[model samples]
Target: MEGFRLWPGALDAEAQSQLVQAVFGALGTAPLYRPQTPGGRPFSVQMSNLGPLGWVSDRGGYRYQPTHPVTGQAWPAIPQMLLDLWAATVGGKRAPDACLVNLYRDGAKMGLHQDRDEADLTAPVLSISLGDAAQFRIADGEGRTRTLRLTSGDVCALTGSARLARHGIDRVLEGSSRLIPGGGRLNLTLRIAR
Candidate 1:
């Protein structure tokens, strides 16, 4: 956790609710879709985006694009709340041009991987959690790993030495929070695609 900053309960109940609503609005424009790895295996979590660029994966590979794969339309603008959060937390640095919205439900979980698709590796990745809590695992290249309980409204940033660290959600604690209408977890990751 040396290079990571965790702000537990960064958003209050009302703020969380508003953010969720904003997510719903974004979803309306670019619906969430299950992404496939370069190997053609589907990811457990479904994803969408809110920004000029969106992170996506398929048989082609993992990269960022300017439009939705399904609708072929540009992603909705990043939510103001998210922009404010990034400014207050990771500001004084380059602003993010992409916001990857990941939805996890039931047994959905992500595997350990590094976020290296961005052009600017030095920029921090700001992640915000909503709905259920998740067991987030982070590890260095040496394989030293640690798990953190990321509850609803938790905000965390991976910067400095941890910017390229391997990280993923081990599992979501179901029914941990009712912030999400259908019982699931939402993770918003802000990054600089270019």
Candidate 2:
């Protein structure tokens, strides 16, 4: 929790299941899109964002904004369970205005990067992993490094020194669980992007 660790079932089973359903239900409204990197190469993982702000990347760069880049529509509201988990994990703190949902299909992996796009680095990032498991890598602000295997219903909070540290998923294991039909991983990261 302080440096880096996993919090399993941070959300109860009922809340977790409903959260997943809420997300997938909205997937049709604002479908996932694979944005190209700044260099014009498309990222391997397709993603979508919810809440007041959504995370996006393309030929321009990586950043957060109020409206969806494609439809110019406000992002879907952040599910109550997500906000509740953040509240339980970091109590009394204002809820994050942005929730970036990363959908990782088999063989899709995110590269290492620091989450500097937000206005305040002190705001802890609340991430939930559903459907399948993935290896999450974290490097310290200095020289320390560690690896964590995040499974379904697992949650992680990035705060204090780790808030600005570099992290990413190594890859999602295919056919790892029956939670999601295609054996994919759904990672919802909550952040105060404003």
Tens-digit per-residue lDDT, 61-123, candidate 2: 999987777777888898887777788786555889998888888589998888889988877
- Tens-digit lDDT track for model 1 on 1-194? 57899999899999999999999888998999998999999999999999999999999998999999999999999988889999998785677899999999969999999999999898999999999999999997689999989999999999999999999999999998899979899999999889
TM-score of 2: 0.93
What pairs collide in candidate 1? none
Misplaced by over 4 Å in model 2 are none
- When summed lDDT is taken over every stretch of 10 residues in candidate 2, the lowest stretch is 1-10
* lDDT to native, each model: 0.93, 0.82
Q: Show model 1 residue runs off by greater than 4 Å.
A: none
Q: How displaced is residue 97 in candidate 2, in Å?
A: 0.4
Assess the local accuracy of residue 36 in candidate 2 as a C-alpha lDDT between 0 and 100: 85
